[model samples]
Target chain A: MSHRLRILSRIRKALDAPAMPSETARAEAVAERIAHPPQHWPLRSIQTADPEGAAQLTLIGRFKAQLARLGADVIEVGSVAEIPAALANYVAANVADDAAGLARIRMGSDAFLAALPWSSTSGLEIAAGMAEAADVIGVSRAIAGVAETGTLLLVSGAENPVTLGYLPETHIVVLETGAIVASYEEAMQSMLAATGGRMPRTVNLITGASRTGDIGGKIVMGAHGPRRVAVVLWSA
Target chain B: MTARTQFDADIDTALADAPLQRALADVPAGFVAGRRRAREELLEFEPLRRVARDIRDHALAHLDLYLEAFESNATKAGSRVHWAASGDDACRIVLDICRAAGARTITKSKSMVSEEIELRERLQDAEFDVVETDLGEYLVQIRNEKPSHIIAPAIHMRAEDVADVFRRQHGHLAPDRKLDTPEEMIAEARGILRDKFLSADVGITGANFLVAESGSAIIVTNEGNADLTMSLPKVHVILTSIDKVVPTFSDAWPLLRLLARSATGQAFTAYTTIVTGPRRPDDPDGPEQCHIILLDNGRTELLASEMRPVLRCIRCGACMNHCPVYCSIGGHAYNSVYPGPIGAALSPALAGAEQAAHLAEASTFCGRCEQVCPVEIPLVSVMRQWRSLALEQPRSRRARVMLHTWARLAQHPRIYRWCAGIAARSLKWLAGSGARIRRLPFLHAWTDYRDLAAPQGGTFQQQWAQREHKRAQRDRADVSAARARKSDSVP
Candidate 1:
């Protein structure tokens, strides 16, 4: 094993209070729990011929419809191949009305946008070169369709950065049917097993809109995250 | 800020607070009963706890790999990742992102980390119109106050108090609205926040968990506001501590079970949404941009210490509900956003022991917090660690000396016995005619409220020793007589 992985293994062992089963039984137990589980929304799993293609199409269709319902303009990109060109065009279109927005477009053009804000723009920079771009960014996680709770689990340092989840006003998550589990316990067990017993540092189990009942018990949605949520479902 | 902590002369002050005392009286019964019922109802609760604890421990131990994986995935998904080493850095990252976005109005969900960082004051200092959308947060925000509790931020305020605030602030819409019921109050607040949600240029939230497997920052709220916050704004920024990450969506189950049940006795909250990166191709009304700030304010340092187990806390609020001190003094007494057992340990560590020296001493060393913590954080031991630190100051020297003197006196049984006898005699004399004293100097605090009855003349050890001695004497006499009779028979 690699040194880092070995150290991780040692730590995992130290933290574990011997689960009553041997390794084989442990795996079997996990599989059993996954098969039949506790009270939660009904989960539907899908096996697709092309997972990426299916995910993209579902997300695009769902987001457009949801945004249209909320009375917002929509932009469509078929693939990562089209991101740069699309982003530039998108920036130019909104430039006249939003000067700061234009600067963001200019800033985002750095080799690495991380340094664009403070002007040390160097290393691993991906410039947005006159391509059609998006003002709002939405990322989809492997989604779960299990309960009335309509929850999603966003782990920090995963396919979507924590920033993308919260920085955008209108965030769209594309959820796969297979990601939904029967209960919270099932979710954790699956996560633990998948990462070879190492859990992610942060797991965001988001259910419903970003809201605050803070102002005198008022229920206001969109307090801090995307004010609207559109969940894209792939057929099982 | 108003209530004194355990180390302050405020121990007595907090004990004397009648309103706080009344509010706290229900904690032991309410939390204890609810927990007992919850456990009884769910047979798998213990297993669930074990699973959750294990999962969190595993994640924290191998945090780097998962964090790397999450960051890579997020970038590929088109979301920008900003790594913050401290609370200040985290806040700065968010502010910079918004400044770049030219965001004028920012709406927020209730985020405890933001509270830890004092994010609101900092953001307001920067001139952004930050509005708290959570009802509890809004109430406290309107009052220019800090949250009194974690789950119920404005837990200290009564319904009528909320009504009064609404009447003053939301007068335009609800001029004649009477906040008689929780439902009515909720309705009024709803009307006011809807407008703000629509107009917000940016939305910031704290994630309960950040899934590394898929690079998502997830939020769970009873009200659907978190969903809207995650979905509506053009810009979405998640401010979260690095510890919030888990490996994958599948691993979120066990902890989620514990979180909802422990927080408010629900099987599950109303909403749980997973957000990955910014909107992909063909997407409609999602944020055009998304940013995830992975904050590491003092956490990486904490990971190297004995204090690391504290990171496993899921923020379930079980410890708070069961804490006696918290019940009596409430959250404001701790003087930090986090209150109760967790706060007692966390505040001192997060904001320097000097700033929160009194917090650790506030405990009666009650084990209820540990007993109920879903994550099983050894809170009492952590509090003791803080106490050890607090004891290093000169002010604690007197207490240390007194304790040492008592320890020395307690070593010799004879001295202990003599002291006990003297104490018993003095108390008996003071209680002449079998009446308890109404008060005593230096002990008036205890005696004024309730009398300490006089003990029996002899101590338990003394009585037992006398009985043993008399039995030995009787045995000797009997043996001698029996030996004499045997001698006579032989002759």
Candidate 2:
């Protein structure tokens, strides 16, 4: 028998010895659970205690607060048109003035971000492609934002390469106000709906800038990924 | 002098190592305190733990079905799934994949499964350049040591020790570079590893959870090294076990909720990436090939045995963090891929009860591990089971005789109380003035480190019976006095 068959048979025999439900019954139970996965209790912090719009506002507020606590900068802009200026301002404030030259912001070919008025902003060069080793900053559009943990859900595709989030020294994500949700389950639901129940090649739920406590038990930021994560939350 | 066991020597060495002692001292304030704060902030932490435990239990109860589902869905999603009956088989499979990819350099993130199989050394023997990417793991790799703690691999090292390792290994760099702080050291390592990430041909990681519904492998990391490890390489290989497979993403949510909080005291790690398969045809960048290797080295036997609940472990390292024995001797003393309470319960199952008997004996059975475990595994009971299993094996005549005497005495309460009372009186006589016995006959191994407290002059049953008799006499006297007072009032 193949290793697969041998392993499965061993598992079957083990369950059988324990007098557990029959294999057929177990399989049906598994199938039923998968078809209708039970919903767990939502976090009390994100429970809806007001109207929809107010609840959304509360979510965005909670999301910003949580991210701030994790050392990520959250910039609120009036609309998409103001994002370039916000990005430019963030670059000016966070990027160190180095002798090597102008700060270049690498991004993917996401239409939502590419269609933005980036030409209006000066003093920064914009490159649209996969991230490179020399890229100091990379911008991507989050598919959704989870308020429960202040996480950004980014799916990998042509529109948003996965490297853009990890390669750059600084990561600036653009999240629309409407894309913020209350919890991971809701964020996953939105993702499944967007992909017609198919998962993307990669889904990143990033909560904060890269950190590590491996050295002397001290948490030092910017270990292997972005040192700083700046989110431009724009009202669409 | 009585001959000391290897386990005793290992503990003595660990306790005497000043640097290790200092490092272990920080764990309570670090991981332990951090978990406390995280738990305080979440009002529903207990409920989430219950749900998480149920999810793991349910998944394990029907693991065969989920494994089949995961295999089918992953195959459909362009991922090749391999089943390995043992660690050697898994390593052979990985070697074949590397050979097929024509890989020279391989970059790895922190995977306890890889450590269990000792993958890096095997790859190095095959003449492949393997680099560990996680900061803590990198430190361990460079020092030619195993990870002391699961999450914090370099938890045993100090900053000065790390700098010393860097200086010796990184000879090409300036000999007198200032590497005083963790910041400077981290920056230096990051600069060196970035090249490895970009140039690696294969990336191997461990899965924190495997979603059978979507056929995705979820890996959580604070440094995002695992992300870059899987994303930058052409071939991404996930080395995980069959127990990691869960039913759905929803099933994973509660586990995720409990993981970071239990492990590092964070609401979430910096990055939690769910990789379904290889890169899509239209994707700009990702691994072109993805392979998931499911390992079952003695786990099938464990599942069949009475210790099936051990499979529900999520490798969060919470049990170890709260374990007193683990805190003292550390992971290296256990001399296994896993250590602490969970390791004590599990190493016996994996390595067998005979060879790993010392691990089960290392615990104090404080029940702290079970209290802190997110999955609520009965770790102490499991350890007790291993102890019994170990006893059932062949043993010395002295040990067998001692155990037989203990069993016989424990069955007869009268004789047991009489023997205990005599022993207690003897100990008290030995103590004389001081309340502690500085030296003990035939038990010098225990008393060598610390003095033992002398027992009181009576057995526990004798003392309790005397106290109860006095209370009964006082109650009767009070009742008679109350009756006399009532008669006088009636007249």
Candidate 3:
């Protein structure tokens, strides 16, 4: 017998319970689970535990605090036009070493970010493609943000490739205050709404810059991914 | 290391190794304290644990349905799912994939199932250059050792040990180069792994959760190695077992919430990527071919057994992180691919209780493992079941005689009390001066490790009876006084 058949038969024999659910039935079961989740007590507890529950300013405050806590630099901008100045100012202040000479930037090809006024930025050559070794900065517009954990939910496609989130030395995330949600559940719901209830190829939920505590239980950031994650919170 | 079957000898070896003892100290100071602090931060930590446990149990109850759902959705997403009946089968499938990809170099993130199958050894034996990207796993790989802990693979090694390993193995580097600090070591490793990541043909990672709702595989990592592993390679193969599938994204939240808090006490891991399948046609990057090997190596039988509750394990390493015995002797002593409380319960289930049954007896029965377990696995109870199975095996004459004597004495209370009184008095007399007893008759196994507390007085039954006599006298006096008061009131 084939491996799949043999394994399935063994599972069946061992269970001795009943036949497994059919394919369409599996989808139906998922729909039912989502609609009437049996385990909502924890979610309820989370809701009751929160003091400033989903108040817009409170949610944005929590998101910014979490982002900073994860070692990501945050700057609230009044408009999308201010993003270039934010990027330029961050480069000017943080770029101390002259070892790399001029720093190049990589941004996602997503239309939302592509429409940004990048021509207003001076001295920084921004490229729209996958990050290269020389690309010191990466700016990608997060589709959504989780206020509970300060995580950016970036969907992978031709427009917003996932590597831009992990590659480059510094990642500058562009997220609007309205995009920030209260919890992962809210984050998932918004993504479902955006995708028309279809799943993306890859959903990257990056909380902080890369870090590792593997050696002697000591944490060292900038392990393999970007050394730093900067958030441009366009609040207006 | 001795053979994996010699768990007793392995324990003795681990106990004597001063370096391993020192290394084991970090776990309690790091993972234990971090989890405690993280729990304090969450007001509903305990309730969340209940939620996580129920989520896992519900997932396991409908595992067959979820697995089928995952297979169908994953297939529809342009990924191939293969079934492996055993470890060898899984290895064969991987090797075949490498051959198909013409892969010379393989980059891997931390995967315990891959360790269980000894994937590295199998790959190297087939002449594939394999690199473990996780710093801890990489250190263990170069040192020719298995992971001592599930999450922190090289927790057994000190910084100095890693420095020595890098010096010896990284032969291409200048001999005089500084390799002292963990920072320096990380830099060196990062530089070395960067080239390998770019050049590797296949990237293999383990799924923390397989979302059946969207046919996505969830992998949470701190160092972003899994990200690079999947991102850089042309082909990505997920090495996961049959039990990892959850019904949907919502069902996976509670587990994810507890996972980081329980593992390293982080609010969230640095990276939590959900890959549905291979990259889309319009995607700028990601593997071209994505294959998921769902290995059912003894898991189906486990799922079908009374021990099915253990299938809810999320491999968070929380059980071992808080295990006192594990903190003392470390993970290598268990002699199975897994180690610690869950290891004691799970090894037997996966490797047959008959051969690996010794693992269950390695615990102190402290119940800390169960208390800290996010999935709320009754680890102590599972260990007891394994002990019962082990007892059914043939035992030495001394063990059989001792057990029989204890059972007989326990059955006859009068005789047991008489013998216990004499024994207690004698032990008290032996104790004599000071408090502790260096030598004892029945507790040789214990005194070898720590000083045994000498008996203070009579047997527990004798003390209880004396207390009862005093209580009875007090009761009679109270009743007489109440009767006198009643007569006075009547007059």
DockQ of 1: 0.07
Off by over 4 Å in 1: A1-236, B1-16, B26-32, B173-175, B396-401, B410-417, B420-440, B446-491
TM-score between candidate 3 and the true structure: 0.93
User: Backbone clashes in each candidate structure, one number apiece?
Assistant: 163, 0, 0
TM-score of chain B of each: 0.86, 0.92, 0.94
Candidate 1: tens digits of C-alpha lDDT, residues B177-234: 5668765777676656666777788888888998776677767776656655655678
lDDT of 1 at B203: 87
Candidate 3: tens digits of C-alpha lDDT, residues B57-164: 767766666777788899999889999989999999999999999999999999999998989999999999999999889999899988988999988988899889
Cα-based lDDT at residue B473, candidate 2: 100
lDDT by residue (A95-205, candidate 1, tens digit) is: 332434332321222222222233322211232221112334444443233332334555444234444445344444544455665444555556556557543433456
* Interface alpha-carbon RMSD, every candidate: 10.8, 2.5, 2.5
With candidate 3 superimposed using the best TM-score fit, by how many Å does residue A10's alpha carbon deviate from the native? 3.0
lDDT per residue as tens, model 2, B1-491: 11115666788899888889889988899999999888877767887788888888898889899999999999999999999988899999999999999999999999999998899999999999999999999999999999998899999999999999999999999998999999999999999999999999999999999999878899999999999999999999999998999998888988998899999999898999999989899998999999999998888888887788888899999999999888888889888789899888888776666667667888889899999999999898899988887776776688789999999999999899889988898889888899999998887866866788998657888889999999999999999999999999995
Worst 10 residues of 3 chain B by lDDT: B1-10
Q: Among these predicted structures, which one has the highest DockQ? A: 2
